[model samples]
Target: MKTLIDYLNAIPVEARDSFAARCGTSFDYLRQVGYGNRACTERLAINLERESGRELVCELLCPDADWAFIRAAPPPGRRRGRARNRTT
Candidate 1:
């Protein structure tokens, strides 16, 4: 299993800031979590999984959580950007 540090290290240095922003945190915080200097919260773990396109899965981030059910279910359709308002 790849560790968070492995995932973080795999990212190019130039993209780290943008990637961290997409995960709703600063690269410094992510670095801390990766190095085991800080705890990775459940919310952050989920966000990382979603943002990493499941490359960093919740199962890897939060091993204690029962994620089998999630894997058993089909993935939901993804929507990008803001929803358009429809005029009736």
Candidate 2:
């Protein structure tokens, strides 16, 4: 499967900054995630997936989660109870 680093490296250098900004994160943070130095948060993964036009899929970004099931489920009206925390 293609990784975030692979996508990052594949894109043009000049576009990196703007892409990162559009993903609501710094290029440095993306670099860290790409290099496996930092964990990619679910929100950031979703943002990257959307901003990258699905180039950086959340399945690859957050491997631990069951993305297929999540996608199959209906959208929640309001989240209940404490948020499920993930360990980076």
Candidate 3:
């Protein structure tokens, strides 16, 4: 089976750099993880999932983590900007 590191390394380098920047992780660190020099942390996984909308945290950190509990947690605050109030 393909490992997570393999999957991460498969991404284009430019996009990986951008994703690392958005997740507040250094590109070097990401490369290290991809190379299997360092293990991925749950916190980092969570941050990545938050920024990229990928559920890698559950897939990597907590393979058995219940999706219902994950969904029950409070949603992240507005990542782009202030919420827009709309009237219909």
Poorest 10 consecutive residues of model 3 by lDDT? 55-64
Top TM-score prediction, candidate number: 2
Span of 10 residues, lowest total lDDT, candidate 2: 73-82
Please give, for residues 1-88, the per-residue lDDT of candidate 3 as tens digits: 3445655677687788787888678878976765768766766667766765563444564355565666667667634557788999
- In TM-score terms, candidate 3 sits at 0.51
Which wins on lDDT, candidate 1 or candidate 2?
A: 2
Q: Can you tell me which runs of candidate 2 are displaced by over 4 Å?
A: 77-88
**Candidate 3 colliding pairs:** none
Q: Rate the local accuracy (lDDT) of all candidates.
A: 0.85, 0.87, 0.66
How well does each candidate superpose onto the true structure, as a TM-score? 0.69, 0.77, 0.51
Residue ranges of candidate 3 with Cα displaced over 4 Å:
62-88
Global CA lDDT of candidate 3, please?
0.66
Best by lDDT: 2
Q: How much RMSD separates candidate 2 from the native structure?
A: 10.2
Model 1 regions more than 4 Å off: 69-88
Per-candidate clashes, comma-separated? 0, 0, 0
Rank list by TM-score: 2, 1, 3
